[model samples]
Every structure is written in structure tokens, then in C-alpha cells.
Target: MLEGKPICGGVRVARDEPIRYVCADCGHMTTTRTGRCPSCGAWGTLESEASSAPSKRSVAARVVSAVDVRPPRRLSTGIGELDRVLGGGLVPGGVVLIGGQPGIGKSTLLLQAAGRVAGTGASVLYISGEESEAQVALRAARLGVASDRLLLCCGTDLEGALQNLWDVSFVVLDSVQAMRAEGEAGWPGTPNQVRAVAQRVVDAARAGDVPAVLVGHITKDGRLAGPMLLEHMVDAVLTFSGEGYSSYRMLRAVKNRYGSTDELGVFEMREDGLIPVEDKSGLYWNRSDAAVSGVAMTIALEGTTPLAAEIQTLAGPTVFPYPRRTARGIELNRFQLLTAVIEKRCGLPCSGHDLYMNVAGGLSIQDPSADLAACAALASALRDVPLPGGSCWLGEVGLAGEVRPVTRLGVRLREAARLGFSRAVVSSRERNERVEGLEIVAVSHLNQALAAGLSRKEA
Candidate 1:
């Protein structure tokens, strides 16, 4: 009777009014009383839903004789690095959401995993909402995915895609933005549509006891492009991030209900596909034929794996009136604080110089254990002296110039030793800390660390 569609049986619901009922079978919303859903046409299926009110129905409880305490088996993605980042492997009925910048290889990685899983005699469903089947096929051919068990479904309608999901062990939704749910009122990629599509996919996967991977786009500021609850609905959130110009990519779990968030997976892009970098330290440490000035090595812990990275710095006279400070792969504020500590405590004046610092190999270092190495690099560049060969630094610098002890010192030192480092400069405050292969050079302050790290003349 009104210009707008009827909410129930010829009942006009205002646009601003709250919805009072939802079709339990079809998930259609309505504000008026109706025996049949207007969208799905189901009789007596309209359920009364309240936004803020609790249910008045009676509650029933059941007693269980015993509980199944067996651990859920994980399906390996066939890539050791990916499997490691995913807490060993994918669990059945679990949903994983991966977000990354465009051209960051999110789709490539998922396709690779699907191919690998399908190789093990498991049926894999790859739902492509963004790319055509031909495009995915061409890419899969290039990646050498010739598995007959890997099924591809290219469409935007979630209901249409669900029809092909039967008898599939693994499912991959290549992008949630391009998918639309049936009977949803919003356009594709909107919050409502995304929520609906995700809910339906997750419910279907859970009912079939299958694991699903959902690809999501990132906003301009590097956040998942969807409702915040989208993350909560999934079992894990993995972020694939890297520099656009750089070939190195990192896969880290932001949230994992089944595994530890501290784990990280490293990969390098190639002509075939992404290859996991097993020698992580070799990727970051620049193996120079000879020792170079303004360079220092430090061991950093990314989750449980230890990584050795080279820190390089350049300190020169500033042409402009104000001195300039720049940092790459390191925090600017951390650099500023380290410079101040060097000026105040180490007796090295960086105030009038333009200081530039970088972590070698595009490896972003967030751990404070590299602080001593950064300070050492800055000091070496200022003095134009090369640090000793076969040595690694591990300590944090304090405001008072003290070399603070770092966590997992033994693990870091062991990694450095395995990499053939002869000496490790650590904090003197560490009690009875020593590694078997490397000699520990304990220092109390930044000045002492510089003296131990740099050549004879600079010290």
C-alpha cells in the first residue's frame, strides 16, 4: 500500500524503524507480523528478533557422559613456511581471513596452497569472485597447478558458489568484496553484504566440516576492508605485507585462535610462485667480503625463529640549518632516541650531523634488541671506522645510556654462533649468560659497547 516494499503482509515499515522479525529459514528482515516471508515465501518461519531484549524462552541443559578430548588434526598447506605461520596447518571447519595490499600476492599464495592441498588427494574448491576462470586457470598453469582435484568456481553470487561447495575438503574464497549474498539489500562490498556473505560461507563450511580461506582487501591505511566483526567471526587473521618495490613478503598472524600470534613466515616472489625462505638470516645479513664501516650485525627474534640483520648508518655534516634524521626499516622515534643517547652519554655529537639509518635487506626490525647494534652503527659511521668482523650486538639502550639486557639472549646468541659469529656484545647486567660457540663481550653502557664494537682508533 506504500511506495516502499511491504515488510510483512502489506505492512509498510518506515525506513528509520527497527526490524522486529527475521525469517529463520531465509534470514530476511521485516518489521511487521507475517506468517510467510516476503523474500523466501516460507510459512510460519518468521521469528521474532529483538536487538536489545533477552529471550523469554525456557532454557534446557543436557548432561554429557564423556567428552572427546582428541586434538583437531591440521591439514598442511604443502608449504612448510605457510604451514609454520598457520600454527602447523589448517584446521577443519576453521575460517581464515587474509588481508594485504593490492599486488601483494595474497591470491597467488592462496592458489599455491590450494594446489598443494589438492595434490594430497583432497578436493579443493577455489571460488574466484574477482578474476575469471580463464585468468585463474592461466595463473594456475604458470604456477604448475595441474591437480584435477582443485575445482574452480568463478562468480559473484554467494548462493551460486555454494552450490559447487559439496564434497570439497578445502574452500578458498578469493575476495569477499566482489561477492554478494542472495536476498541482501546492500550492494556488494558494503558492510551488510560482506557480513552476510561471510556468515553464509562460514556456516556452510562449518556444517560440512571444511576449512575455508577468505581473501579480504585492505583499506588505504592498511586495515581489513570490512566490518570489525568480520575479523571476530573468523578463527584466524593473517596479514601478507611487504614493500611494493621489494620482492620480500612477510606473512604474520595478527590473531589466531588455534596457534601463537608470535610466529612469522617469510617468502620471496619468483617467476613460478612464492618460495619460502628457509635461510632467513641469509636474506637479511649482507655477506661482505671485507668488513665495512658504518655497518653492524644484530640477531633479532621473530616469534621463535632468530634472524640476523645488518644495520647500516651514515652520519655527515648537514648542509641545511637544521640537522636531518632519516630511518628505513627502523622506527624514526627509536632512531631519534638512540641518537640522543649517543650525544648525551656516548660523548658523540650527532646534533649537527645528518644521520641516516637502515636495516639491511628490507627486513623491518621492531625488536628493541637491535637497539645496541643501531647505536653501534651510528657511532661507527660518525667515526668512519669499521666494526670487527664475526661479531653481533644484542642489547637495548636506555635514556641513561645503560645497555639493557634483552630477552632470549641465549637464543639470539646461539643463532649468531650458528651463523659463524665469533663474539657477542651483550649487557653486563646479564647474570652468568654465556653461549658455547661465541665469546660474550659484556658491556654496561653505550660508550663501552661502542668501544667493544668499533675498531681501535674510534674507541
Candidate 2:
């Protein structure tokens, strides 16, 4: 009898071809018979009892639900807001990796996550492989962390840190780059040291049923410091992203092995520490109200929610042979394309227009849903008029100046409607020709849409 371990178990017997599957690691093939991979040496890449004989009983192993695994003992990082981003709460024995720019709140976030999880009665071992114990305690005191369960260990030695920890179910290594393995001679943050130390700690956590969190440093070019492959090795990759100059900090989940990757946790940095943005819309509206030129409300989508953010555009005739195009959150050529479409579709004659766009409150508008908003703002600034009150804008403006439809138009409408927006300028394909209870203006072309916005403003 030939015996071999299955990559993930549940194999089949087939006609003499040798049960085969490709390695997810190196793209190497296994005949479901090899004990260890010859090409990459990665374990669990072969199937169990996959016979090369023809015609055998076939049984399937269904994929197990996440719930099938026992619930991880959640550790509340005293920060309730950060915890929510971890999907209800942190899963026991789950390793989380957080990266950010220098001094952009990696320590603050981990300390906060520590305090919150500690506050929830879970033990938290904070291994500050970067800063000294005195420095960590000083910062913790300043951050108002008084939890007794939050244990602080100041060490840069990877093996020592993990060995000293016992019965402690949660570990946090601030800035994984700072820790070096026992025999590693590379600089602390070098690629070799970072990968070896991080993996060793992560493996220790899983073996001991302890969840570990690692804070990471960024490259000179703004990428997570260390090897690029390091990011792919973690259970989750979260980044504290935003303009470093702004108080608004966004916890964006780029890769999540456990939850929805697109999910984000918003926060505001204050002297008191990082505060969760509970009512993002309300925070968005924190800016004072004024009918300023080049300013308009645009609906932008963040995951499932459509945000009616303020869009500010500046238009002045350019005298240069080649007009300059500068934008922040919105794309540059996209702005240029929309402007060209506006001229061709609406005959707005924006040839002399110098358009600058800003998504209000320091937030980014990555979706095309803001195309019409850009057009509307440019129109308002160009025509020197204030758009009608209680009016909202949606849909993307195509290169031909047509109002292109978007996904989840109904949600956009409902969001606008809930905000007491009396009228919504939407693309034609949203609903039947008309929507009930609210006035919906459908435009299939960009010119018609521009005319709609310009008409009410001109009126």
C-alpha cells in the first residue's frame, strides 16, 4: 500500500494517470503520490491515497464554513473601532499584520487595539521590538492605557520574546522590522530578518493557540518596509492610510484571509488618541456650509454605502500652450477625459477651463460615480451659479458625454432619498422610467444631464 499525506485531504482514485494537482506555491505538479514537493519543498501539496487505478469509488470533501472552526477567543484592543474592522472582533490565534508610514500611528493603533482587547478581559502581550520598555510605558500612559491585562515586553530578540510568553493568548510585536532572529546578522529591518522573525512569531502563536499582531514599517517609497513577499504571508494586511498631514486616518484592509477585503475602519487622530469615525457622513458634513463657487455635493461609494461628499472644482482659463492638469484623490487623465467629454457632449466650451477637483473633508473618491459631480462642479464654477437646493448627482460621464450607469443604483438613490434630497440626477437605466415618492431625472446623454444641472442653477 502506497501512503502519502493529502495537501488538504479528501483525494480520489483514477485511471492510472496518477491523481495530479498543481502546487499553489510554485505551480509545480504533484501526482498525488509524492510525500514532499520536489520542486518547492512546500508541505500539504499532494493528495492522500490517490490511486493511479481506473474506476474507484469517488467521494467528495465539502469545504468547511468559517463557523465550522471554533470561534476564536476574541481579544478586544481597548479600541472598539479597530476591533470592528477585525470582523465583530479579533479571532483567537489569528495573526494580523499592520503596516504604515513612519510615525503614522502603528504604535498608537496597536496600543489602542491592545488596550481595548485588554479592557475586554483578554490578556495582551505587547512586545515592543522597536521602542524600549520605558518608551512604550510612557506612550501608553499618555494614551491613557491603564489596563492590567495589557503586558508590555520590550525586546528585539524574536525567540526570546516568544519563549518568555506563556499562557498569554495574544502577542503584539510593534514594527516587525525591529525584531531580529537569534542568529540573523542582517540589519534589524532587512528583508531576511523581517521575514524570518515575523514567520517564527506567527508560527509560535498558532502552535500555542495565541493570536499575534505585528506592526510593520514602510519603505522609502511608501511600501511596507521589507520584502514584497512578506505582505502575502500574513492572515490579513491592514494599513493606516491617508494624508500624513491630515487628522483623518483610515484603516484600510488590503488583504484579509478571514473577512471582506474591501472593508475599512475610519478614525480621526486627536491628542486624546485615535477616535473611530462612527457617523462618517456626519464627519463628512463637519465642514461649514457655504454656496462657494467650484463646490458641489457628489455621491461616492465606500463599499456598500454611497457618501454624498463635497466636490470642489476650480475653473480658470489657461493661457499656456499645454494646460496643466493637477488633481489629488480623483485620477488626472480621468478628469481630462471627463472635461473633453463635457465639451463634446454639452458644448460647454471648457477649452479654456483650468479644472481642479477636491473631494471634501480629505477623503478620496476612487469611483467613477463622481464623474457627473465633477461636471456639475465645473459647470457651477463656469456659469457662476449655485445648484438648486436639495438636489443630488450620481452616474459616470462617459468619454462621449453620455451618463453611464453604475452598480447598485438603487442604493445610491435610497441614500440620496434618505438624506431628504428632493431630486436626484441619475442615469437612465436605474429603475423603470420613474421612481416613486421622489423626483428622479433620468438622462441618457451627458449634454442632457449637464443641461439639467445647469437649468436649475440658471433658474
Candidate 3:
């Protein structure tokens, strides 16, 4: 007989039972051991552990009225860009997991935010398991973040860090992988330990009604270095990304429970710390009046923010049988598709020429609206003719080479006009709304757009 009374659906198992295996990479559990995880296909990731029966408790279920539910108020992180990406600000009891490559300024951004929140007369706790107190202090000093209300703790014991959660209004864990729970099996950074640490942090934040941010690491594939379950357990998942050779950094949300994930935050790493960039277009646009071959401008929208970007391409004769196609800041497949479109639809000789493309200012754009600009740049380079000065392209090219209307035409044109652009090439199907100080050149086909935008003068 069991020593303790069994509750409803709660059963005690015998001491001898089959051991279970759990995948360390994807958090998959199975009674049978396996060499690779069926979920994520990662080999040698399954770890053995004892299996335990789950207790099923029966409790009264209450259905609350939707009218009684009120949205939680947000606490500002004192950084406008960060706040924008976070869907306005951090909510009480919300857990945010932000991941990035090493040396991407995750700690610096959080420390600066903590300092700012502490400056507002609210206590903020910063817990670091990866760095020593002195190291963090030295970096904090370098960032000029000195606040009495900002408390610091350095340790891997998650329970010890949560001890101060109730005393603080905001909390930050430098990294979840570096922290461990009291009774968790395996070492820190293991799948089990990561899950345990995240669960503990989530529970503590919910109980204390404080906003918490967890810094996470990214794998070589640019994915968050943990089980998929870690992302689901958090309220928001943000990615801080930037090129190693560039000072610009972009922060965007992959998941947000409280708000929209369309917002983006731009920052520049400076001597003091990460500074928010107000004029994002200036970073990508060269404001030059000189018309050069192989260069075309476009206004790409990052969320609601419109940025003027320059796309440059080069086309030269190749000696090899198969000409090389190289692209940076844009997908190679997309570039190839556009090259094929230009060659077939516009009658451009791209089959024998080596093509190279890049987005200016080290900004990676996924917006399809820049398709027209890319095609125009490629055409201009191949023809050795410079595109018209003060012109912007806004359209999506189809496989048949037809230019399709893009969303937010007026927004893109207005941004172009603001940057002193005089003309914009757009799809003929789009409504011709007159933007102030901007002329719209609508074309139904890529051929028409190329003919209209490219100047007769050769480079």
C-alpha cells in the first residue's frame, strides 16, 4: 500500500520502471531510448532519466467573463526603440526572451535599460551568471549607468536571484542557459536545466507581478540555442541581430503575446552604449545627386517605419561556363529569380555575365517591395546606363515579369519625397495618388519600368 493517500487520478508507480529518454536539443520525451531526436533530427541528444507518473488533480473550473478581463499596464524601459519592438513596453509579469550572437550588445542594452528604469525611482535587479560582478560593474561604469536603485547579483543559483525579485520593479537575467535550478538534473545550458530555469523565472515573475527579461544565446544557425519549448514559455521572443563589421544593430520580435510583432528597433553602438537611431533612412541612403550605373533607390518599410534604401548591382562578362551569382544582404534565390525575369522579360543579357548585388548600409531587407529596385539596378549595370537621379522604385515583380502593386504606396512615396526624391516608379495597377513634391511613374511591366527609369546616357 502507498504511504500517502492518493488524490483523484493520482497513482503511485512501483520503484522499478523503465527509464525514459529526453532529447537535450528539442525537449522530446520517450520511454524508448533513441540515438537521434525524431522531432529535431539531432543525433546523440537523447539523455536517460527516470520516468514519473503525472498527477491528475480535479479542481473547480471557473469561466470568467471577457468583459472583466483588463489588459495589463506596461512599464517603460526608457528606450523608445526597445519599447516600440516590445509592443509599447514591458508588461507586469511578462517574460521576454531576447537572443543574439555573442558580443552583440545584449548585456549592454539591458544594463542601460535597467539603469534608466532605476532612474525613474523604481528598483531594478540585474542578475548575471555569465559575468562576474566586477566585469559587469566595469562595463556599467563605461556605459555611465550608475543608479542606486539598480541592484546587481552574480551567481548561477536561480533561487537566490528570485529572492530579490519581490523587492524590485524590473528584473533581468543576463542569460538563462548560465543559470540553474536547485534540484534540476544535468548542468546549466542542458535542455532540462534551461527548461527548469525558464519555468522558475516565469513562475516567479507571475507571482511577483514584475517584468522580467531573459538573455539567451543563439546557435551557429542563427536560432535561439535551446529547446523549442523555451520560446513558447515566454511572453515575447526578440532577436537582436547585426553584422559583425557594422555598428548598426536591429532588434525585432518573433513572438509577442501582449502586442504586435511587426515593430522594429534600430540602434548604433557607440563609445558610451547603444544609441537609438531616429533617422533610419539616413543610414541606408547616400544623398548623392550624381547618377551612377548599377544603383537604384527604394523605400522599404520595416514594420510601420519607412526606410530609404539603395540597392547596387554589378554585371560583368564571365569566363566560366556557368557565371557566378553572388548576393549580400538579400537572398541568392530571390536574386536569381529577378535575374531570370530581367533576362527573359526585359531582354537583358544576364546569362553570360557574373552578377553581384548588395543592399547599402549593411541592412538586410526581406520586403518584396524592393524587387523593382533590384531589377532596375541589375538592368542599369548590364546596360552601362545610369538610372535617373532622384527616382525610387516601389513594386513587386511576378514570374512573368509583370509589376504588381505593393502595399503602402503613398507611405513609400512620401518617404522618398522626404529624402528629396522627385520621382517614383510603381505598378500601373496601383492608384495614382499624388504625393507632395513627388511624381509617380506607373508601369505595368518590368520592361516599361526599366525603359522609364534608366537614362539614355551611358556610364
Please, what is the whole-model Cα lDDT of each candidate in the order they appear?
0.88, 0.74, 0.91
Candidate 1 regions exceeding 4 Å error are: 1-55, 61-68, 319-321, 431-436, 455-459
On a 0 to 100 scale, what is the lDDT of residue 284 in model 3?
88
Mark the 10 consecutive residues where model 1 has the least summed lDDT: 10-19
TM-score of each: 0.84, 0.79, 0.91
Query: Which rank order by lDDT, best down to worst?
Result: 3, 1, 2
Task: Report RMSD (Å) for each prediction in the order shown.
Answer: 7.9, 8.7, 3.9
lDDT of 1 by residue, 1-459 (tens): 456555767577665535488664446788887888898686876666566545779589875555755667989999998888889999999999999998999999999999999999999999999999899989999999758999999999789888888898899998988899988766898766788889999999888889999999999988898666688789999999998778889999999999999898999999999999988899887688586788999999899999999999998898788899999989999999999999998788887799999998887899999999999889989888988888889999999999999998878877988999999999999877777878999999988888777645444
Cα lDDT of candidate 2 equals 0.74
Off by over 4 Å in 2: 1-80, 282-289, 414-420, 432-438
**Cα lDDT of model 3 by residue, 301-389, tens digit:** 89889999899999899999999999997899999999999988888889899999999888788999999999999999998888988
* Superposed model 3: Cα runs more than 4 Å off: 1-19, 48-57, 455-459
